[model samples]
Target: MTLDSETFRALVTEASLSPSVHNTQPTRWRLGPDGRVQVLEDESRRLPVGDPEGRDLNVSHGSAVEGFCLAAGRRGLVVDVGHDGVHVAELTVRLGGVSDPLAAFLTQRRTYRGKFEGGAVAHAAMARFEQSEDLIVAQDPDHVAELARLYDEAGLRWFRNVPYRAELVSWMRLSRRHPSWSLDGLNAEAMEMSGIEATGAGLVLRPGVFETLDRIGLAGALVAEAAVVRSASAVALFHRPANEAPFDTGRRFHRVWLSFTQAGLSAAPMAVLADDTKARESLQADFGIGGERRLITAFRLGVAPARDLAAKPRLGLDALIV
Candidate 1:
């Protein structure tokens, strides 16, 4: 490590908070030579069923890189970032460039999967979230309701698939007794799982619950749909041409997330829209997107309730740095 231990740990702490599929926390950090921070992908942390194509992983790495830059900017440092490949990103820190106004919120951002107190989101509040021209956000009530239904419809296919259910069951660390309980995977609190559901899950969750909850996916599937509809105040969707780079979109997404954080509003990423092909097409068509653009990401924007905490787990600083 070229940087001092304290500086390195601070960078890793902020960077690791970047959200990943199933809270997998797939990106790791190390202080490289010449004052650069190296971001490495932990391929072992990839979710086979949820992100087999690694699109989620690629976007996740992008978010982490943005996070590190934001963290540095908070301390009056400007960082130049580069994505070398799908797995490797390098950041060279300098002392120039204007700091982000919301840079202080790099650590306070959380993904709220629960219901939001619904109302009209101020247009001014949302306008700042459009970091780039690529973002397509819908804040009206009718449009948001329709998007919710589409999310529900798209998830049905994944619900019946044995492998997908098995993979979800594997990540359901519903009990503290589970070995990965403190390190990674979704916990009972994060999922906002009801008592009965959590009990049933804790009783039978294993590497693959193909025999247990695999049959119970119908209920789980409905809950997933309801959560999106119930919680969102607005929906932000993004698209890019097939030949263009999608990584910058992730960077823009994180800035919007941090802006919401500074405003006391919370949001949740809805990757299911991009994960299912039918869902993605429906989204593009419904939104009147053109120019051979593909839906790369979508999220529900709303004000989260008070006292809720982030439930996704992460490895220790030492564990994250190699």
Candidate 2:
């Protein structure tokens, strides 16, 4: 059965809402004959310096594809997804009779990076989160500690280099003033910084604090130690057996993220941890992802509490659409 054009359009729009590295919505959409939806990577939207290897882009596109699949599935549709690289994925939807209540989450889900409520996540919910073969969720305090070390190591290594630092600054949208970097780059507000503070401080690390912060920012479990702290209730690290042509990482990310969204969780990625080879290897060593199957994305999951965090805006659909 064929889906109406309006229904297909809404699904694509919902899919595009998926988060990316610094909110870089890198996926492109093309609707084909007989209800085929093509989700391609727009290389132009890639973070060349920050994510030179394109790992973040893959995960971002994966999130989009995942959202698309969920949206389609909710409407009694079966989706077959294919990917060529971190940037491109193709999803073909054929109308099916299956019903998915979680389909409603496609529009409701948001990348919430704030203080999560106290108490352990329900085991049943966590079990559902672990169901994805492409992803692994870390629940133990030991696991969080090990993962924090990897994240700190990666941040220190990457942020120290002048080039990567400059690349990061380039993406920092400094104000309610500048606009070119809209919807994509890091919004100062999301960094736990207020508008006035962010504008004055810019992206430069303060001279002395850089050393301490380089080790671990406020995001890790360390800074929030005393508070009723929670990282992603279930931290999912997406990986592939061996990097396939282009879509290996993207395909893996999409399938896993979609599964999480299907299970009623607010997911947010911590790219600072995922970009480093050493960090990935350390995580692999701890998690035992051997051989060529490398880590492609790291996502944290939990119920988001009401807090005032930065909400990065997106360009209108017209701007993203070809």
Candidate 3:
């Protein structure tokens, strides 16, 4: 059956809430003439430098697709998604859907980027994560510190790439004065950066200033996230079957994150660990990731201080539906 206009709007709005690289929100929805919904990619939002292979981009869309499906389930509707090898998917919706338990945490999930509270992660929580076949938790202080160093090395390596740095900064909403601060991309507040820190980031990420800082050996320390990573109660490595498509991987990615939220844990993705070949290989070898598994990503997991943060910035329905 065709989705009513109100239902369509509601579903698309919830779907848009799914996270994306740089918060680009590249997934677009179309109420096709045949009543099925068409999921399309907005090529203009592609992160050519940061995600040259489009793996992350595809993953972003996949998460949106899962979001849409979950939203439908919440309304007692089912979405049968049909996807070939292409980037697009057609969703067939109907009644008689069971709501997903993880859907309860969707609205509560945030990419917590700030420092986590100090303390050992609860044994129960750590045990739950450890029990998951797809996850490996590193709670050893030495191992976490080592991972932090490797993360910094990988981050600094990427920071030196001119185009990559430029592409990242372009999506950064460093000031509340920036026009798109509330619309899309990474805003300073969500990043947990103070005004001065935000301003400094804009300057530090500039090629010339970064070069000078690196020459003096200050850039590495400046860009380092070791403190943040080391503060985590534990780090998790997310892995999947080696040949699984990223779209499928992304579906599970969102679910796993929502599970973290349900367990009273906050997390932030450490993409550098999975994106850098050396870092990825190191993690796979050290973590005992079997040959049949692909290391998808990593996360720093911990309990965050209670605070009422601003709502996530997202484009309105008009911008998402075409």
Error of 1 at 66 (Å): 0.9
lDDT by residue (68-148, candidate 3, tens digit) is: 988899999999989865637888999999999988777888998888886655435777888899999999889999999
**Taking the tens digit of each residue's C-alpha lDDT, what string does model 2 give over 99-166?**
56655655555665555553455345778756566677887766765665666657667767766666
Q: Candidate 2: what lDDT?
A: 0.64
Candidate 2 regions with alpha-carbon error over 4 angstroms: 1-5, 32-40, 77-94, 97-102, 122-124, 130-132, 180-182, 200-203, 206-234, 244-248, 258-264, 307-312
The candidate that wins on lDDT is 3
Residue lDDT tens for model 1, 248-285: 65576677678778876777777788878888877777
Give TM per candidate.
0.85, 0.75, 0.97
Worst 10 residues of 3 by lDDT: 118-127
| Better model by lDDT: candidate 2 vs candidate 3 | 3
Which window of ten consecutive residues has the lowest lDDT sum in model 2? 220-229
Q: Global lDDT of each model?
A: 0.73, 0.64, 0.89
Candidate 1 TM-score versus the reference: 0.85
Descending-lDDT candidate ranking: 3, 1, 2
> The CA-based lDDT of model 3 is what?
0.89
Candidate 3: regions farther than 4 A off: 84-87, 120-123
